[model samples]
Target chain A: MAKFDISNIDRRWIYITILLGALLPLFVPITFAPKISPEVKAVYDYIDKLPPGSVILLSFDYGPSTLPETEPMAEDIMKHAFINGVRVIGISLTEEGALLALKAYSNVVKEFENYGTIRVNYGYDFVFLGYKSGRQAVILSIGEDIRKTFPTDYQGTNIDDIPMMFNVKNYKDISLVVDISSTNTPNDWITYAYSRYKVPVAVGVTAVLAANYYPFIQTGQIIGLIGGVKGASEYEYLVNQKIQSNWGMKPKRIPAMRNMSALTVAELLIVLFIILGNIGYFSQKGNKRR
Target chain B: MAISSSIWVWIAAFLTLAVFSFLYKDNIIYKMVEALFVGVSAGYSIVIILKHSFVPNIWKPLFVSHNLLYLIPFLLGLLFFAMLSRKTAYLTHIPFAFLIGSGAGFALPLVFQTNVMAQVKGTMLFAPSHYPSLGAFINALIIFIGVLTVLFYFFFSRGEKTNRGIIVKTGIAFIMIGFGASFGYTVMARLSLLVGRLYFLFGTWLGILH
Candidate 1:
């Protein structure tokens, strides 16, 4: 407890401190470990049990602002689906997200070579349905008729032309609906996917939005949830541990792990700062009273 | 033909920058991009609705199958367009009411299954007799404590009671810590987008990373 003037500390310095603390880890490359909470573990296990050729509807319901947290999750989940031979039908709720989803999908598809073949391919193995709006209306129609919701892929190919959508009759046929969102889009998924059609639903949401979903997870509306990047990283870790062990892949646990490390240190510092500010304010009050 | 990569890169960079412009000030550039985003999204949604829902469900059955039953849904959809017509807008209420009713009906059963029943089942624990191992026991205890403590923090009815003061205090502390971590992580997540934007500018435009 040094008698230092806490009020004199510049806010910019704190931001700098946090920024450097976070970014430095990326280059240094220490092991970024996750606490691996039960909810995340459940999501990991559910996806693990999915058989190859199982249709998973992945809605990338996040815009660019949330890509930092959500992109890694989407990438990791798609990677798992690819490696496990699961057929992924990608779509987006927000218009801006459609291109980003495709870009991320293509990037993961490209990286598939470096990690070796996961026995999956685009069009044949997976499909991108692009972006559709109307929120719950779009999802409800999709439950009854997918061809009605998306007549073509983002590229404007006929839905029937894509082999992936052939067996995708309705939401009932979908194995799992994984709504990867930056906001509350998962609520709509729960209403339309699980409520209307009784399809199993999972969510990968931003950390801020994850708390509101506890009720859904509790009720069985959501089979499991991957909260933000950490959840995504955990899923990647589990999948890599299970299937990719023979190939010698260490898993891409970056982004989440590194970010979490910085976050922990920053939290401790901010709490300490807040406590010091309180102490300073109380002490000044006592002096004034005297 | 596919849109050129350079052209996409430029568009992405500009839109990304325009979004970031909100951090400084909401200028005409930001407004223009925002408006375009809205217009494009609205147009795209109309196309998707026509292709996905309208054609297969309404148009195809009406025109090809020549089924009179298809008229019900087609007319219902058309009624939704009545929302746009201010004079006869009250007619639009039928479709809106059906949508709300259907959506609510969908949510009720699911809310029970997923939120209430499933959660109750999930929380129903093992008889520690089965999980005699230290690690398993500790994990279960930690989860039990975390759940109860978090709940206790929200229960303000008996909050001032001194009997469970320590537990409540600990619970409140845990909640604060959780909030701190969540907030800090969210900041990093948002900042990461800014990082991605910077990467696009430098790596894609200036060829710095390459």
Candidate 2:
């Protein structure tokens, strides 16, 4: 057989392969049914069971750098809340996340409008409290008084003027707290919100950080977690399932679902590269032995 | 292929391609976009910090709301800039002391409650009689063993000869498995980001995919 060499393979070729793996899937649509993990299910079930008009706090704690992994989870969770008639109180602990929070809200609200059934009015049904400094201090203060921490919403509108803020004074009024983050904000939430106020906490984090939070989940400090794109896809699947079953609504195609095929292709390419590299190493070792 | 009509979409597409060009080789386009991104991000962060945090919490409270108590924090914050001046740098120490002291004091109890006590409680292998199940028993046992082994692996106080026990070997295995899983998840995370960018290029900017 012709000599098989992976060691000398051009790096550009690998890049092209990866690019193709990511790009081709967009042209040929493929659907992936995510195996919804227990953690993801817990999040879905908790939000699903919340009473109508219950206030849910969403802390967007990521920047544009993590938008891909974080945004889908944010969108899906917001959609679920809106569909379930749950009031959303949005906040961002990170400066970069402030714009992202608004974008996520706007995207979900636009999609919700397409349903033409549930009307969501800004400052009434939902509000974005925007970014705050003193990360841990802000979180602790919010546990005591949200209005005190955020005197006004993102648009410079007074919190007192917002109808949704009427009952939401602190974590006491909130049903659940979901933080979508690329950093250690979830840990802060667990330490401050859950440990102190006994508020239910959930997190949607990048996959790399997901493993670190399992200990928190095991301790029941975090009610649920949705990690990275797979987690986002699973959540999207759950939300779509709920909307379909409850309202008999047609499920809209979400970004997470669309991008999963590309992820699969990229993963397969990586695996292939790993196998090839190993084969090359072994083959060279055998030659040396000769 | 159908192209986009929107000027913003074209701009986004151009920027995406410019950034992606770094995969082949770094060029002026990539450098320009990178600088633009950094400049925009820094400028935006300053604006947001001023509008949301400083204005609402410090400025408005001090001036508009006339909450005199806010002046303390306001002054402390201003002292942060004092570090730039050699003469006034001593003032920075006061705020730094207060910050470090208060932060540690606040975080101490909370960290102990969540990270220490809660983690220890979660590692308890002895299950209560009410929720007796074989699966739970096995899972708890595994977790308990894993935690101990992992901890033992990091115990460098013991001599190498003493630490070469079967328990240490098992700890190595568990650590390896943990590392492998982390590696796998990290790969997944990176691929997800790539998929996201491709989707944006094709689905959003190009509008060729549905």
Candidate 3:
């Protein structure tokens, strides 16, 4: 048999072990305490404080590539907004995001329908304005004239034609702008919407993009922020709503939890491997010393 | 059995697991998953662009209404196919440059105000009235200090031997912690996504567990 090589034998074994650990959670769905940070809690409380019929604008700026993270955030925020009777106007910055946002809304709306209370539809209570180009330019223009940005809704109905557009004017009229985005357009909302228009801006950002907004959160330029899936799950927990589940708790949380279970075993294996590697290094060093 | 809408969910679940398998080995399985993702994503984007952008802005305006200005986008859209024509490939640059120029023109000022000006203005325009608690004050102070020191550390005029050395180091530490926390949180987030796929497969689709 060839000499046992810990470094280069095969990395697949480690992956298989990890995969098994992660898979165990699907069967045993355990509820765990989520460490809700102040930033996340602020977002929860901000939405909770809104009066019924307050207009909330949600920008779905992510494509299918980031659907796993942004979708749940969009879902929960929509669920919360509707449950609280806050009018939600869904918009998309990315062209692809329009479909994703619509799909997410309908998915959650169907679930919302199961409760037999809220009768949410496309044109009535919620309006999906679909994709608009010009990026930040659109955000800026909408502050002055929403009609200029959205001349027509997704279905070709003029803004004036829609009843919901009656009270909706500019960013000032919007109670909060929850930016569910992968890009930095949320910063534009903070600039034009929050800073310029004084509309409180909340962000539901991918985990990678969340840190950039922390400074804004600390300074109160952004009222609240939801960072990635964990943040989404945390927000879901606080609202007593299930947006997207089993992402963390099932595959990830279970593996992580099970990892804690077989942690001692893995630790011992690692220690043994490390000690052996060290011995090999030291033995070579001793030979050179002579 | 009916190849219902939920079958897409199952296909998605399987694709997710297949992609996750790459963590174990970068073999044919992972490559197949990667290729499938690339194909599906391209197909999806094409559909989205045609349905959402092309039809709404270009086709409807040009052919349906006979709007002459819509010809510009039509011509620009045609520029996308120039790359396929090897001899006239440079024509792609016209549209490319237009896109790049317009994208920059749209984004630059906004970036300047939002990312640079707004953030700086926010830092300077702080009021202590918001949070009366000492903890809030301390946090604000720390954030202010962190910003200043991190900025100073990049300054070439004053070397590490300056009076601000300790402050700079402390700032660096805070920045590092913030970055590290962000990174750790992101890892957990991605892990959550993988977990979500597994849940769909095991709990919802297969019904292996109650």
- In order, the Cα lDDT scores of the candidates are 0.73, 0.87, 0.72
lDDT string, candidate 1, A182-268, tens digits: 877887787667776888888888877876786566546788888765676666566667655757766553555555554555556
lDDT-best of 2 and 3:
2
TM-score of chain A of 1: 0.91
Q: What residue runs in model 3 are displaced by over 4 Å at the alpha carbon?
A: A1-17, A65-68, A155-161, A191-198, A241-290, B1-10, B71-106, B124-131, B157-168
Query: In every candidate, how many clashes are there?
Result: 10, 0, 2
Lowest summed lDDT window (length 10), candidate 1 chain A: A22-31
Write candidate 3's Cα lDDT for A119-181 as tens digits.
786666689888876566678778998887787888888988887788888887788899999
If the candidates were sorted by their TM-score against the true structure, best first, what order would they fall in?
2, 3, 1
The DockQ of each candidate is: 0.22, 0.77, 0.33
Tens digit of per-residue lDDT, candidate 2, span B1-210: 466788998888898899989988989999999999999989998998887777777777799989999989889988999989999899999899999999999999999999999999999877545346787678778889998987877883276667376777788899898899899989998888787777778778777776
lDDT by residue for model 3 (B40-145), tens:
8789777877876677777888999999998997899798899998899999999999989987886677567767776785566256676678788777777677
TM-score of predicted chain B, candidate 3: 0.80
